[model samples]
Target: MRCQTCGDATSPEHHECQRCYTPLGQPAVTPGLPTYRVRGIGLAANVAVGATAVLYLVVALYPLIGMVMARRAMANDDPDLLVSALIISAVVALIMTVAQLTAAVLVIIWTWRARKNTDAFPGAEPAFGPGWAIAGWLVPFANFVVPARVVAGVARDSLWRRATPPLVAVWWCSWLVFSIGERLATRADDRAYEKLAETPFDDAGYQAYVDHYQDALLRNTVPALGCVIAAVTLILLIQRISAAQEARIAHATPQWPTAPIWPAQVWPAAQPASGVQSAPGAQSASGVPGVQPAAAAQPLSEVPGAAPAS
Candidate 1:
């Protein structure tokens, strides 16, 4: 049968269309199962994440910009310019941080909704419960693995048990790299600051501290690149899963036929066959059972004016 929504051809056994996941016919509603309405949040999530990715690109330029500014300031012996550059970089970093947090929240909400919708799909068994969609990102060590698993489950169940794309793994790996690399860079900065504090008065030690700080700033590019990659891949994944869920929801909804109903006609009863005679007390030739033929016509002897019968 062709799907009513997408016009895709599907087998009689399939309740939903393969292309759009729209229900082929009226689907049976299971008793006691709560209905989950799937909403399209992918676009919003993508916008936020795409913005975050762009900000990551800007953040990546920070280390290179910082190193150049530092060197030029040192060469020109202008301390003020160096201070100004640092302040600008700080402001940009702050903005990027806010955007990242906002994107994360939107993504979590989208995933939660998607996971919940899987319950409404026929034969869709998600690996994780809907709660994990949020909690997976909050738990410390488990966050590394759980969030990916949750996303994978949503993808698999949403696409009618299809295999998840490699993009999920790529996104997870990049996210891990960005997270770990950022932590290392932060620690390195802290150690460099501690050393500088210990030798505040030594000119040679101060020079070494400056070089260390510049090197640390340069190293930030790795994590920044990782963040960029992670954001892009995540946006794609979100779009795919959201679209699939929407299709599935469309399939589940009941659609009433639009054609008008006409009243049925009452057929008249059958008549006996013409010119066919039946013996007296016999059934009619029309083949109507238990219906005897009319009484035979009166004889001439029974007429009043006729001579008496012998």
Candidate 2:
């Protein structure tokens, strides 16, 4: 068999890889998971990713509308009309933002599940422990680095530790850069809106707000584009990883016809002791094997070396 860690060819009879000493035949935490069920997670994640990608595409273009509106407001085309446009834009942005966040959450959940499923096999040794997949994205400063590392590790392990997925770096870089841009732009946007609130309809006072709004809209495009690319790349990575795991599990195991074997026993039926005298020529009434009648099964009553009746 090929060693998972060291890529060494070794005799199949050995329990550990000769080159790297990695243990073989280790039991899975979730044994007997069906392929279709495991694949279902990937399918669900892909759906979320596809939805996110489409929404991100909308997000990318949605900014253009905002930029145009801001420009119109700056030109003082119509104060009431621009105010109404801003309200409408705000509502649409809120709904889409909620949707995008939901999709992102779904992606994380499914990806984490997929990584866990890979652990059902020995060859797929993900670098990060499973919790980081979720927590990596939640922790404040650590999130920026941890999530990317976790993804890279899972991507490599999913491929049988053979090669890293090509787009993983791209996905991580774009995601981080876009996130930074989004945060900065949001702060600027808030300040811009605060200024606009100070003078609801004054054209001369609106220029700063209009400029900042335009900047925010344009800035959002960075993350939106990143979201689109990351979603697509991630969908592919998930599909690849899940497929590899399915193949590995099928090849590494053949368990459908097997039965569970208990590790030890207790509460066994009582048995007759050796050398107790039984009525001459009598046998046990029950059909149990190797158990003589009580009379011939007394415990330690006979001499240790004494001959017994034939």
Candidate 3:
């Protein structure tokens, strides 16, 4: 229907006109995702999340470097340096943890909004919502199993419009398995150290346990890194999908003409017949008196011998 206020086309589904932003009583406006507006917001939110993530990484790096240096100092019997490094590591780790968690929260919020915008468009479903939100992150023991699956589900739904993407599902399962294994390994290492504290440790046994625990921790880092890398890759993939979807919508929409083209080039101009002069005064074709020039321009009621104009 055409909007009564602005005469812009609107859809029966919407009560407000998209073009004029007016409340529609009878007329309507065009129906669509309003892609341009939604994408702008989505992109801004995404950028904010990315910036926060970068800040998290910066904070995290200091702790990691400090931890390595502290361990080296301990081995070398540098007591003063070891204590300083430990303090620095604790501070950096605390800051890093807080920043990382905050960034994750922002990411979830941004993705949720983006999903809503996607739903407004055709051929799109909400990929980020409460269901996925709860499943996506830490929640006691539940965190160990749900997050990988949540990531895969969100990706599959948003990018493929499916409940699962084959590759993503398989990789996510592997992530969950490795994550559980990592936690179990960590617990076992702690238990071993507790046993050593109870029983006096021989130099050989203590060194051997230390070596083994260090190896286990090193191995677990691989999977943990894999999960992080995967998350980053998936986010980039989602961004590409957003761009592609926008391009498709732009291509499909009808375009208006830049300027009007008239038919003057196609038809010949009309010419008067010989001796058929155009009227100068009040004269008609059959020699009858024509209406005055003033009357001709006035209402037909005032013009004698002229038909009323509709």
Residues 237-272 of candidate 2: C-alpha lDDT, one tens digit per residue = 778777766665555464576687855523225545
lDDT for model 2, please. Answer: 0.64
lDDT of 3: 0.49
* Tens-place lDDT digits, model 1, residues 100-187: 8988898888988888777766555588999999999999998989999999888777655467668888999999999899889768
Please provide, for model 3 over 216-303, each residue's C-alpha lDDT reduced to its tens digit, 9 standing for 90 to 100: 4554454455445444554564475456445544544667878876544222133344333334464533343532223223443455
> Each model's RMSD to truth, in Å?
14.0, 11.8, 13.5
TM-score of 3: 0.46
Sort by lDDT, best first.
1, 2, 3
Residue pairs clashing, model 3: 9-29, 9-30, 10-28, 10-29
Clashes of each: 1, 9, 4
Candidate 2 lDDT at 168 equals: 86
- Give the lDDT of residue 263 in candidate 1: 54
Best by lDDT: 1
